[model samples]
Target chain A: MKDDLTDRILVVLSSVLMLTAVYMIFFYAPTERVMGIVQKIFYFHLPLAFMAFLSYFVAFVSGVLYLVKKDIKWDIIGSASVEIGVVFTTLVLITGSLWARPIWNTWWTWDPRLTSSLILWLIYVAYIILRMSVEQAERRATFCAVMAIVGFIDVPIVFLSARLWRTIHPVVIKSKSIDMEPAMISVLAISMAAFLLFWITLIRIRSRVDFMELRIRNLEKIKRGGME
Target chain B: MKNLTYLAAAYGIVWAGLFSYLWYILSKQNVLVGRIKALEGDD
Candidate 1:
């Protein structure tokens, strides 16, 4: 269908960008003198974290729109974003742990950034579980909208945790400077763009599936009524 | 140690995680479409 043309193009663009970013990450970006090769994980870890944050932001905006417009489509977008966000958050935690194991010599730590990120993951995960438990469509949508907006409170806390507290996590962006080489910065920018476009493609696929499911449910209900 | 193992694991997990989620979503989509077609055929 014509509706899917954008989705098809975005999928290809994102995949190509992702491959380019990966090649640059390995070959082009200079290795950190102190951390050595393990430092390469930072290229991926930061982008995954960025995408997770973007997902929650989209969810928050969709939640607000759903409340204002009283539309089911907004609910669909919010929940889809949360679902993708949770997967992204899970990866963030795993990748962080991997990086931490080698550098800090510990797999897990209760630092402010780590703790807040875990809490953020749990919040949206609970949001997904909430959707699954409720049967009444309207009530479920309302709960999802409210929860998405409220859960977004943790995102800023997660972002500022390193700065706001005495955390072991590295603060990449300080008051006036970023501490990476020019090449590293370019690779990171490309990686972020790649992931953002990929996230959009994912949203399109998820929202289409949800709309189809909703239509099927409505049709089934009507068919049952007709039979009765 | 230079931590090559950790590096590989980290990148591997990222790719695996993303691909796994994509697979799950696509599978769910396929199943739903099948149901819709079945319903339409019956009517």
Candidate 2:
């Protein structure tokens, strides 16, 4: 019951954040002169990309914790994070395509950032699919943990490759020399906050669902006398 | 000439994507609710 209440709260909070983000992006955020209305996609797209990267980082850290402590909780966290990361990465790709269609005059381009994002999405999808392929839970989790750690390391390399390639994508804010307008920065900030909340809510919901599933499966095993 | 085309495409994708997510969540929740009900029936 307590867990149910927590889930309800998370659902409510997530809905609020998502709606607020929509409102802010549509009404409050100033339009970009260059991109016009299509610029609004940035509020969602870039944040989704950032959150996806963050999820992978969490997966890597959880993987390390699992390896060190041999705790199933750490494994669960790692797995859950990877699942959420894949979802967000997929969103990033779709939203990026939408944005790129307008601004870049192409639905899909070999731009450095765009290409790296696509690669990252595929790698994470493969990670999840790899987990599903294994029959044994412990072995699956162990292999996935190692993969999570390696995939997270690849993110920086992806960024570096994007820079080295000098494709059409804009440089990430921190690395760029030019300053953004105050309005644009504020919109990005609010969008980031909303996205952060949404990510946490999704992670919590996913983790709880995974926990219940594992529990129910174990119960069935016990009933069947599988365990000694 | 080009801007209107961009606007239509952007809004179309956004609405379509949101509807897709809504459908997904609704279906997933329905499945989970059914499972809980089945477990309750077993008890």
- Using TM-score as the measure, which candidate wins? 1
Q: Choose the strongest candidate by lDDT.
A: 1
Worst 10 residues of 1 chain A by lDDT: A1-10
- lDDT by residue for model 1 (B1-43), tens: 5599999999889988887887788788889889999988888
Question: Model 1, A201: alpha-carbon shift in Å?
Answer: 1.1
RMSD of each: 1.5, 3.2
TM-score of 2: 0.84
| lDDT per residue as tens, model 1, A76-147 | 999899999999999999999999998999999999999999999999999999999999998999899999
Reference contacts preserved by each model: 0.75, 0.14
